[model samples]
Target: MRLADVVLPDSAVCSAAVDVAETYASPALLNHSFRSYTWAAAYGTAQGLAFDPELLFVAALLHDIGLVAEFDSHTVPFEVAGGSVAWVFAAGAGWSRDRRRRVSEVVVRHMGTEVDPAQDPEGFLLARATGVDITGRNVDDFPAGFRAEVLQRYPRLGLVEEFVRCFEDQAKRKPDSSAAAAIGNDLAARMARNPLERPE
Candidate 1:
């Protein structure tokens, strides 16, 4: 499906969102980001959550959309730059108060270690999902909150198989760079622990 089709609540604002995300994200990194988000939505679905895939997907796609404006004329790190852009985009887009707040929270806190799973389930889930997709292990080395449900819903072996396939697909499509190399390494490690030979 088209990138636009995957992200929703379409508007001029959303179009700007894409442009914003593209500013600091290398083509490859952007693909990785999308893949990570897609995996999260899939995992959430497997766990029986009625998540808005399109909304979550778009949110994931544009989580770093703020980087555009921040890095345009500054030398700050992309994370900091992206956070500033996020605030601007949220305001310019006329995002609902809650969405603006959540988007801002996601951008600013994405790289931190201060996450509180009990207090912010969605944030926790997003962080965990990003970790798994990027590093093949949940941050803090914790098990997924919905691990049992995911396994029960899809069977242990099936879940492993699905994740393997998703990882492989992401690896193949990932843009080349240091970040992609890291993701590749993580995927390899995950695969070694749970091998799933692809179909011929």
Candidate 2:
């Protein structure tokens, strides 16, 4: 299916989420957020994975807010901070307490190595999509043409270097953070080698 076939949510919460993300996120980060949701939604559609599109859209868009100066936390990991931001955003959007919690959980779990699809389809889809975007892992799972369409809509810009630098800064401050783990595993080199950076 083409990118247009992947129906996206356009609710009030989704609109507000775009506003907040645009206000805080850099151009590249904002594009990355958009691409994350696009990838997740498209992948989910391809796999027939049941998910909440509105919640996934909000969580995916705001998942990296903690990396921005306005929301960055000095103590907690970026994902934790992002999760908190999602919680508050959801509350403001008039979501139920449980709905707010689920969005927060999806945001926090986006960084997971593997989120169980049966347990949390949104989380699982986000993790898979981010993995594809960031490290090019499972890049071959989706149709090549669909992937190209998504990238055309939301180009990577300078996401590779910028994201690596953000993670490095986080690692410097929080050695116990997941950023540290990613760095310790040589994330920079991995990012450098991401296939998306290469020509088709």
Candidate 3:
């Protein structure tokens, strides 16, 4: 997939997601978000899957918005918080109620252990793409050339360290949050072994 061939939607909903995500997130998170969308879209294209590109784009871009200070939630997990933010953003962009709900569903489900593609097309692809970006899982699922194209356009930018740090902060702030659990559980080890991890 050539970077030039990728087409992001021009709607206000999509545009707002891109702008808010980029503005709120750090360089690492922003790059990861973009890569997530690219990988998911590329995978959809490869699999002959039909999806709402605009919906997927907004979901992917805002998936991690909760990690940023402005959107952090005090009680619920970051995923839910992020989902709510996306939902509201979509509504403000004039998305239909169903479409906005889909955005929330995708954002919330992206962090789940698995997302059934039949049940949630956007969520399924988002999780798969996130796995590749964050953990190097299933890197070979996409064509090497396609992956190369995406990485070239949006490099890792030290994502592992940055994400780990962000998760650590989330853990400290909300000891019972899912982010905290991930940290306690093999987060450090997983990050250490991440194929995407770059040497300092």
Every model's TM-score: 0.52, 0.97, 0.91
**Candidate 1 per-residue C-alpha lDDT over 42-68 given as tens digits, one digit per residue, 9 for 90 to 100:** 555545555544335445666544333
Candidate 3 stretches with Cα past 4 Å from truth are 1-4, 198-200
List candidate 1 segments past 4 Å from native.
Answer: 1-15, 50-55, 64-80, 114-121, 138-200
Best by lDDT: 2
**What TM value does model 2 have?**
0.97
Q: How far is candidate 1 from the true structure (C-alpha RMSD, Å)?
A: 10.1
Q: Positional deviation of 92 in candidate 2, in angstroms?
A: 0.4
Cand. 1 Cα-lDDT: 0.49
Rank by TM-score, descending?
Answer: 2, 3, 1
Candidate 3 lDDT over residue span 1-200, tens digit each: 56667777788777778889878998889889999998888888878878889899999999999888898987888999999999899889888999889999999998888888888888999989888788777777766676777777888887878889888988998998878988998687787786555422
The CA lDDT of each predicted structure is: 0.49, 0.90, 0.84
Candidate achieving higher lDDT, 2 or 3? 2
CA lDDT of 143 in candidate 3? Answer: 62
